[model samples]
Target: MGIKEFMISFIFTSILLSILFIPTLLTKSFAGIRPSSFSGHPQASPFPVSFAYLISASKGDLESLKRTLCALYHPANYYLLHLDLEASHEERLSLLKFVSAHPIFSQVGNVWIVEKSNLVTYRGPTMLANTLHAMAMLLKTCKWDWFINLSASDYPLVTQDDLIHAFSSLPRDLSFIQHSSHLGWKMNKRAKPIIIDPGLYNLKKSELMWVTKHRTVPTAFKLYTGSAWMVLSRSFAEFCVVGWDNLPRTLLLYYTNFISSPEGYFQTVICNSKDFKNTTVNHDLHYIAWDSPPKQHPISLGLKDYRRLILSFAPFARKFKKDDPVLDKIDREILRRNDGQFTYGGWCSERGESNATCTGFGRHENSGVLRPGAGSRRLKALIVKLLSMRNFKRKQCR
Candidate 1:
């Protein structure tokens, strides 16, 4: 079946399923809210804001995924980890075991694994599907102000405390997405191509299959494209999933055959919708270096990129090699994280103590104690510049 027909069939099936499950969802009691163990050091931040994260990885990425999760973990945030279906059962099991065995993870109950993995083809609709799947799951399970998508290769330049503090003052509706209407070379290379991803249906992975026919650029709604990495507000995320206006659903079907749908799906949806277009911040909030003539992939960051990475003041950076020394340097200097431990945050440490180890929750009086350090200050500066009068409105959806 064609992409549009497939989407229609899937929607019909989903409607039926929703009909079957709606009563149960409404009547069934959710898992009991476990009281904060608050038995150890209180790891709560003073900031009220929380972020839900979707971290995606593929085969041979377990180690880097673990490290990235550790560096980004905070009691206040929610994390959903997706290991693509291309990974072996053994790897998935090992990852599951690791998450289950982590004491703090159990105590906090914020981390989750996408038990049924999706088969993801590079630059295909499956990548976008996996992201939306995680978003749906997170939306059902947690309360968060924003949703941020990262890959296994991405690591944080700032702690969760720093992030929370920086975002505390910002308007909740803003979405940090790098987008542009000018397709330039992409007009012919990407917009007109009709490619099918077998990963959407097949058990095994395969490259996107291009058809003999090409499609005209979409005119019903203007097409916008940009970095796949983004920070979306909770309201925007809900709009995409619920799709009250049908724009998100229509664009999803349209982008099914479009290459690198992840880069454009949300962009097109947000910009095309009058409610969200004005909220765009025009930045992906990631520090990444590409070669002079960029290749298929971005440059793998190492020690050489440290200064530039910090100076950029982005919350995250990507495409690092597993166990790179630069990661250790970041842990030591930027995050002050000990080996195999969560990043230092207010929830884990004492108020006045210097270099205090994060013992666990319950020791501090309030779970919302914030220990935003120099990183928070740096991030705040970046955010101020992004939202400034001269930069903010001028950069929206243009």
Candidate 2:
């Protein structure tokens, strides 16, 4: 090809690629979107509330996982960190030791490591199983107000104090889950297909196997599916894990062989149950954006998505690139955390060389120690909108 033609082609391709990818990072929150607030509440754990966190980490995620754990750490909360079996044994041991050696963790005694890890296939039922395992463990060990599921790639947009402060006013039965009843084309492609996940029985990582025959939708209940991540209430989690009702168990057995069970299992169980249906909040509380033709995986958040991410006012976002500069900005601005430091909160009382970023701790006694920042205001706005007259009951588990 001639030099002129090559240059022209290169320029056109560059422009097209830029156009395709740039807006994901550049867009701000949808225009004129202001949510109301119920912000006058006191800043205390209203009733000695505790949170159980199930944080899952996979291969090559040790550093980011550790960083995230530190940033999200709170003495009052219970944490169970699982290293996926796909990760090497050495890696798991390394993470275990890191958690064990931490002075604060040892003192608080709320952190636990999943000694026996489950094998996880990306986008498979095994991921759901792991979440259930952690839930069961938490139910057996301690009392908590809610169960929060997070991944190593995901980070908090607000401090734990801010989270606790906001949630203190909420009714204990509410579950934060983003869901939709519209199956669209997925009904034919995903719902009817029968696929066996090898991770259930095999030691090796492999793709889910599909059967030739398709099955009909269940007559017993409606199928609702949405984002896999959620913040489940403790009572509802117990209803799922150790319920007097048998449907949760029955559905568990049914979903054991289902593909992408994480997306559908909880939704199906909650929507099917008359007792829990009214308790659903129907918001995933995550800030995620997909491509024009949304793919099986959402796009990785990058530097450009900052404006929209902040404006969305969601407390958490997912699928960030490792060591992305956007994370640094979030740490500095939103979380008020320095690199490799804990996010600033009322519990962090000691001043470090730079600033008091959870350098030391003591039991925070004052009920009025809340110091909510701009992020808290943003999140409060979102919470109000989700709970407002227009949205509260209208869009739940439909």
Please, what are the lDDT tens digits per residue for candidate 1 over residues 84-153? 8889889888898888877887776777787777788898887887777777767766678999999999
List residue ranges in candidate 2 displaced over 4 A. 1-48, 350-356, 362-368
Candidate 1, residue 397: CA error in Å?
0.7
Which pairs of residues clash in candidate 2, taking residues 3 or more apart in a chain or in different chains? 25-304, 25-305, 177-283, 178-283, 178-284
TM-score, predicted candidate 2 vs. hidden true structure: 0.85
| lDDT over C-alpha atoms for residue 214 of model 1 | 74
Give the TM-scores of the predictions, in the order they appear.
0.90, 0.85
RMSD (CA, Å), candidate 1 to true, equals: 4.1
lDDT of 2 by residue, 1-398 (tens): 34465345434423322232222322221111111121112123333456788889889998888888887876567788888888997887788778777766665566778776778888677788778778876766666788999999998888887787778788999999878889887788888876666676678899876666777988887888888999999888978866779787667756655668899889989988999988888899899889988889888998899898988888888888789899998888777787766778766653222354665463552333555567777888889999998998898878
Which runs in model 1 stand beyond 4 Å of their true positions?
1-47
- Model 1 weakest 10-residue run by lDDT: 26-35
Clash totals for all models, in order? 15, 5
